[model samples]
Target: MFDSRHIQTFAEVVRTGSYAATARDLGYTQPAISQQMKALERAAGTPLFVRAGRGLRLTDAGRLLARHATGILSSIETAHGQLKAITRLESGRVRVCAFPAANATLLPATVARLAASHPGIRVELLEEEPPDSLRALREGRCDLALAHSLGDDEEGVIQVPLLDDPLLALFPAGHALAGSGRVGLEELAAERWIAGCRRCRGHFLAACARAGFAPDIAFTTDDTLAVQVLVAAGAGIALVPGTALPLLRHTEVVARPLTPALGRRVSAFVLAGHETAPVTALLLRTLSEAAKDLEPAAV
Candidate 1:
């Protein structure tokens, strides 16, 4: 419980071996130096100095405190410097959780931009879909989350809209609807479907329900590549986000926009009070810019 200021005065007194000289060196009056020593002795429960004929001599307790003061002060200074760096965006770490499609499309560009602009700000990425990413964000495991929702609101987080990822219809190259400019959900009502992650499957089911028919989902997987391969092999047709298409598209799979244009809204989520944190704000801005760059291809 020793005061830092008292410890500093004590260290200077020990070094100078004279109360008046220590006060002069520290720009404090000699009586002020003496008061600090008395207070420090009270906190330490032992004497820190003994009179030594017009000078000062350290007691055993004083020597012990002096031995450790340098390290303590150095650690305090280091902490201050690091905090300043973080405030200036010269050094920091941001943990980001995102879905697979966003990892493949949006993250690369965003990370690249951050690295180019702020090399000292490190980014760590984890892959998880909407609810899971949102869960991670709420649980304090991640600083930010790149999640997409079908117009659903999440609780306890601030959502910053980034882009709209339209769902595109996928079919085998020679399928009857492959050459169509656009296809409606009702037209494929009888076809077996390849569904993706849980949220995506839910979106698919809802879109189908709105179209007035239930789809028979035959295959389920989270991998976009596998989804494309299944559609190419004619196992079933599927609907995938436009962001996922550019990352992995099978040559024999034809992708066309859905006639009714079903899509999910992608956003960056941060804890309620963390939106203005330096690293978090920088990442949010970079993500928005990256999403804008992908607009032409995403639609």
Candidate 2:
């Protein structure tokens, strides 16, 4: 049987395209790399690499083995992680990613609750946008990612809905529409707008399209506090997420529900089979319970 180390070296060489580079990456000498390659070839009973020009190239057999090696390495890593988690469910580490607003509002409460219930479980949190959060989950950089879906559902990921956070209109206290209670997107079409990030801008445009008019963005920003400050100073109106309300330090800005509510559907994503991890299950429960108070009341 080929040693795992030898197979790993072969994979690294395949990836790096040079035995010298792979050796540098893996902390092995050039001779050691050669020994590993030779041993792997011996175990396979065939030469895996062939000299071509100034560099080496993989044989057809080598290419086939490299494809299988990726899955094998991934499985080994997953098994090791599972074993570590299972052996210490309460004391294990759970790495999580969340968008900024949720990290500020809901996640802190959930983390507090989880710490109270499972003090030994070390939960590491990463703040990222929805796209980055999903990427982290796909790459196994995080155990759970709290993300907001605009429309697309990620394949190979299991998403558990936590809550719906509506986009509300933020107006200066003395603005004519401030006291309207609720307003339609059409009503604000002519008003100068404070734009958010790319995702937020997309949602804003989508909402406007539904209302039959385009918005004229006067300024663009993604900082929650900056958006509030700009809106409060009468730079422009904005559609801010409900979860971001808590982050607004200015009382000069008021949030009113939209005529036809448009918003993000927040969910927690985990790798297809990773939801079974004891810590993941526990944290999911905690997050769900914490989100209960954030949901809108039935009309």
Candidate 3:
């Protein structure tokens, strides 16, 4: 077996082009570096390096070992980083996939809390809808997935309840129903509507159906900020998830709770068998705390 230290020293000598420099960089004496190289050559049963005019040059065996050493050393370093991260949540990366609303509201606070508590940890947030987010988690593209669904357990993924976000009505400030304490879907059926995302629009459609009317959808968009902008411009009213309120950039829009208290449950998804990871568990705890602190919607 090729000793990792020998391979590491060999790679360092190749990079630095001098045994003395490699020794200095690695905090070892020049003789120690020469001993490691000689041991590596004996293990290979060949002279791995040859003396050039002023520096050491790699032989064919040395070149091959150097190429393999680079990848082996990289993998070992990555493993060490992961192990360290697991041991103390000190350093590593956590990739998170979340939908737009959750990214806007809960995720920011959760990420902030985790980052403050564990400054060495790196967090990556990707925006994806429920289905895509779950897919990313299953494909190993993300460590955690924040999703919104109608309280259904998906196969192969474990769901951890994060929050129950109510769907609310949003309209321009001057709209007749804007100031209402609560708005019924049936009451606004005749007005033009800015349809939200596919899932959110489906929920709105179902609610309108239950209320015995079909909404007149004037436009469809998946962007929460754009929805707010359209509503502020009086393009139409919208049924927005409660979490989207924080993303509203337009002050002309007013949010009112839906009369029947319709809502979707937001949950975090991870591979069914994998949930005890140290960084993931830590972030999940922070997310739970942020969810608990969220303001409850008025019915």
Candidate 4:
């Protein structure tokens, strides 16, 4: 069998195109680098390199090995990293995918806590809504996902409930219902509506339907800040999640709890068997803690 160190030397030689250069880079003698290549070629039962004047040329077998070298090296590196992290729990990376509201509200605190507690652990964040975030988690693009559902059970993954983010009604400060402690969906049926993301809009439609009216949607946008801006301009009223209320930038807009209290359950999702992964588990705990902090004050 070809030794991994020999394969490493071969890949380096392929990159630098010089045995002498590879040796210099890897801190070995030139003859040692050449000997390692000979071993690799013998294990493969084929000539991997050919002499071409003053330079070396890769034979067909060498080209084939080179094609696979990158992936092989990457897998080996990842395995080593995982082993090291398992041994120390001091260094690792966790990629997280979350929706905008949770990204704004929960991720900052979660990342901060993780950084303070485990300075060597790094977090990479991406923003995607529901099914997409879940897809990313399953595809291995993200280690964790902050996803929300309107009471439907998500299959094919481990789900940990974080919090229920209530949907709040937003109106212009001077609007008649703005001063009300709680506004019923049907009460705003005649007013022009500004819709948010697809999921949020779906929830809004469902809530309005339950209240016996269809909203007259005049504007649609996925940006919470824009929704607030529109509401402040008296362009249209909107329903925004409580977690996103803290991001409200327009003072002319007022938020109140919905009469029936519609909400989405926010949760952390991981691959079915990976919930106990060290870094991911740490993040899950941090997210739960952050959500608890937001619970009492949200909206």
Candidate 5:
């Protein structure tokens, strides 16, 4: 059997493509890495590397072993983490790729609770739209992503639904609808509409179309803040998530629920099966509980 160190060295060499680069990464001499690889090759009874001009390359057997070695190393690391967590060292890192709206409300309390409960864990917070966030999650750039849905795309991910975010109409405060608790989509459908989400903006527009008018597209932007700013400036009106309500600046903007209410479904996602990691599990539980705990109060 190849020694773990030798296996690691071999993997590193395969990863970097050159013994010298592996030496730089592992803080070892090139000769040392070469020796380790040679030892690993001997143990496997195969020539694991092929000499190439100015660098080294993995043979077929080397490529196969490298793949397995990478997995084995990861499993060992996770196992070590499990053992540490078993001793109350509850530790690891988790990331959240979420939209700014959710981050403003949900992430603060969730992370605070996490810090209090598991000081050993490191948490990273990022703001991204659902589509972008899910893409990041799939690319392994983040461990978790908070995404919004309109009751669609629930496939291919482990989703934990958070809340049904009430959709609201945003308008300049002194506008006719400010004091109105809710406005029908038709109320502003003919008004100039500066919107968000080129890809999904049609959903909101289509909802309006169902009410008998097409919105006048005055402008389009992705930044919710910018959208709200323009709306506050009387640039146009927008249908925005109520979760984004708290961040609206000034009394100039009033967010009132829309009648015939269009609400958005929000959810958290972790790559399936990866939810088992202790750190990820804690985050999932705490986040779901936080959402539940806030829902009634916020309602």
Candidate 6:
């Protein structure tokens, strides 16, 4: 009979594309990966892969076995998830991957609420960008992922809208628009801007473009705090989520709703089928509650 261990070994090797990566991923030695592959091949009575210079290619038989391996691995995962779900609240870890903006604002309160409600549920948090968060969902690295939608839901995740954080203007307290409760986007036409990730979400850039000006980025950084600090220091003005405003308060910065204001919607994601996990459901509930009192940054 094809053993579970053999099926897993084959899957890891294929998933990672290298024996070394499989070893690191599974926390096994390279020799152990080799041993498992040999045993799996012996069970199938055929060689599964042909070694190339630094990589290996699956044979036709290997490809056929891989097809079966997928189902086998998925079944095993389902069984394990079921067990975890049944026992999770009593003693287990819930992993969450969140984006930077959430990290600054709603996330801390949400996590605190969950911890207070369910002390037994050990929750581990990871800060990842949208695609990385979604990848964690697909690859089983995280139970729940908090991320913003880039307007495309192509990752096949089950996404639940968490809350909307309006995009706001972030600038030094003394900047021209600081005293205004809100300012029109078009008013900042010629100001130097502190850009967010250009490669990922075009939201910040798009907002500027729609406002009829292209930002001359004085600096670009992904760390939300750093972005705020730079703007506070008068390095440049930035457009940021309302969530980020609270974190930037001590720096004497100001945040105001933009005219034709845009909001970057936050969402929680789980792998399509594993949405029923108790910890995930509870945390989602907690996040919703936390968002209610989130007054956006007062400044």
Give the TM-scores of the predictions, in the order they appear.
Answer: 0.94, 0.70, 0.73, 0.73, 0.70, 0.68
lDDT per residue for candidate 5 within 1-299, as digits (tens), equals 76988878887787788989999999999888878887888899989888899888788998888779988999889898888874463767788999877888888879888889888888898888868888899889999999887356546678888888877788898888889976888787668888886876767877877999878888988777888779889999887776766677765787888778887777889888977777778888999888886665343
Task: Tell me the tens digit of each residue's lDDT in model 6 across 143-201.
Answer: 98888755777456778887787877877889877899779988888888888676664
lDDT of 3 by residue, 1-299 (tens): 78988988999999999999999999999999999999999999999889998898999988898889989999989998879767798876789999887888898888788778888778899998878888888889999999887356778777889888888889899998888998877888688988866665676787889999988888899888788889898898888888777676787989998787888888888887667878778878888888877746422
Off by over 4 Å in 3: 1-82, 295-299
Instruction: Report how far off residue 279 is in candidate 3 (Å).
Output: 1.1
Ranking by lDDT: 1, 4, 2, 3, 5, 6
Give candidate 1 misplaced runs (Cα > 4 Å). Answer: 150-152
Q: Write the per-residue lDDT of candidate 1 for residues 1-299, one digit (tens) a residue.
A: 98888888887888888889998999999999999999999999999889988888888988898899888888888999999999999999999999988888899999999999999999999998878898899888999999988255666678999998898988999999999998988899899989985655777787899999988889999878888889889999988889886765568998889888899889999998899999999999999999999977978
Candidate 6's TM-score: 0.68
lDDT of all predictions, in order shown?
A: 0.88, 0.86, 0.84, 0.87, 0.81, 0.79
* Better by TM-score, candidate 2 or 1: 1
lDDT of 3: 0.84
Residue 1 miss distance in model 1 (angstroms): 2.5
In TM-score terms, candidate 4 sits at 0.73
lDDT of model 4 at position 96: 96
| Candidates 2 and 4, the one with greater TM-score | 4
Count of clashes, each model: 0, 0, 0, 0, 1, 0
Query: Model 3 Cα displacement at 35 (Å)?
Result: 24
Top candidate when judged by TM-score against the true structure: 1
On lDDT, the candidate that comes out on top is 1
Off by over 4 Å in 2: 1-88, 296-299
